[model samples]
Target: MDLRRLAVAAKPMHRTLHALPRPNCQDHAFLQMRRLATTDFSFLLPRRHAGLRSFSSTQSVPLSEVMPRDGSRADLKILPTDPDYLRLSVESMANMSRSEVSQFVFMMNSYGAVILSSSNRKEDRLAPYTMLDRLFGTPVPHDSMNEYGIVEINPANPTSINTANPIKEHLPHTDDAYTENPSMFCTLQCIQNAPSGGGETVLISGAELVAALSNKELKSLMTPGMVSLGRRPASDGSWLKVSSIPMFWVDKDSGWLQVRWRCNDGCVQSIDSAARPAYEQMDAVARHAIHQLVIPLVSGEVLIIDNRAIAHGRRSYEKGEPRIMWRKNYVGDGEIASELRNGLCPSYSSMFEGMWSMFEPKLVAV
Candidate 1:
């Protein structure tokens, strides 16, 4: 069984702190946060790996402290190499106050991405996914691959299943843009760094692009039927499942903006011929947005993104240098961790079939 599967059940609840002690900032802001966003958080974290113990599945588990067992403060560095910026930590994340939680949420909502300077233990991926699951809903797991484990971006070692390609520069695009319900949020944790220093992560803000586009471009984007194309690879490295999705849509329930932009050659060809002009305009605008924020992530840091509001990509790195990253996706606004403890959401094929079934009729109508 996978470690993640072990974490879902049988593991006892506990916390791991960093080797060094940290300051306890019990200020007024912290107090206010504790007063407001009180949610029992221990059930969401992975239990201590070394000391395995049993717990009653039916009993109410006390929330444990989040231990910083992975990366250290020294490993964190700001993009463009700024030395004075304050580094964030993943230690004790389960114990953060309501205000602190609100701040993180606010940053993600407003800026479309938030960076946390922290260490990642093998089990540390649970911290962010659990937190997001508590605040949002269950994380929609990756379909093409099970385990949702470490995805190493090794170009020289491209596999049929992995999304991270080390040698190739990934253009700005939403992760799983090909899926029916693309992951609502994506979290990336760095475990190893490239030796030659090339693969910087690039981010583009949808909100920024929306604000900058002319009314004509906005109208074209909002004009309903711009299909973005993509494919799923089979076990034998063959592309088996081809999919098409609208580039942008408004969620009927939330009235919020959602996007499915992919600039890859095949994806671009999937755009409706009638909508080519609009696609060209959107392409230009998206390029401008990403140029504004390029981030170089090193080991011991995590980047969380709002999938609906931002598109992210990786810069090409020097060949032969190694880079490894862990990624997890979470879904929902009100879902909890325990509900999804057994496993992530349905497989991608099933989810996509359902989405396409509903969409085919609409496409015909259009």
Candidate 2:
């Protein structure tokens, strides 16, 4: 049976016994981050993957210490190169029950993308899905955060789909649904066919995007609601940029990371809020962030991402031949990890520290 089916079949729980190790400010004292000037033109893009849903399903499962069973860290560079920054782990993530895969996916989800080459082998994929079910829960929610678990078919009229603003209404988001965990990964396999812009997938990095912008623009872009002239998710009519979280946030416990800002021009939310003044403070940074990288996806392979750790979008295709890519997703534990650690550790935090003291308090012991 498919992992998704299995994860849902055996309703699992988030057992707290398997939590990730805590970071010591002394051992890994953060370095005040600053990007090189060249970082402006080519921003980082999201890795690509699925997401989790409702927190109720979490197993109280303790997040396990992140282990590198897949040795890609040294070899893998999060940037494009001649061989392509992509690597296929000799391991296949199929056939394992949802419980088994969750540990690995959870680890990878925290960092960025975990490439499963043999995932399609039918042996590796199932286990991970079940792991997700056992550790996080099942019936992963589909939202902008959890998108890609169910591939979104970009309309021929990119402008139209962009205009449709399907994400605003908060209806049936492409990837995540039911829960609000945001996506964890995207499992796609090429079916067949290639006619002009047929099945080329694209991706961008959230961390790299902000690094490209200036302090002024960065501050302004974080304005709330993501004002936009785009259509609301699943609804009609146009509104300005409207997003749930700021484009950027530096969780002291976890680290630095950018939320999903699938935003565009002429749309800016966050008109009235404490975050407003900060938004107005950044104009150039906002523009630089809006334009960033292209984590392109080719045929015969798939990419995964931690939606909370990153953001994702697709490329436009022509009509006639239908586009197809297999997709599935699951949720994670919760923000408790942030409370436990102070903040999440996305790639960006390594560069700069923000005024995140505002989020201080306590959770699982700082």
C-alpha lDDT values of all predictions: 0.48, 0.35
Candidate 2 lDDT over 42-73, as tens digits, reads: 11333122122212123221111121212222
Per-residue error (Å), model 1, residue 208? 4.4
Over 1-366, each residue of candidate 1 has an lDDT whose tens digit, in order, gives 354454343322212222333323223354233322221233234423311232222232211111111222111111212211113454444344565565554334324566765343444544554555566566565543345443444444443333434566666777777666677777777767677777777776554444444333443445555665555442354454444655555554332346666665343436677677656655666566333467777775778776776777777776667777666676755532222111111111111121222222222212
lDDT of 1 at 43: 25
Q: Give each model's clash number.
A: 9, 116
Error of 1 at 44 (Å): 35
- TM-score computed on alpha carbons, candidate 2: 0.48
Candidate 1, position 99, lDDT: 59
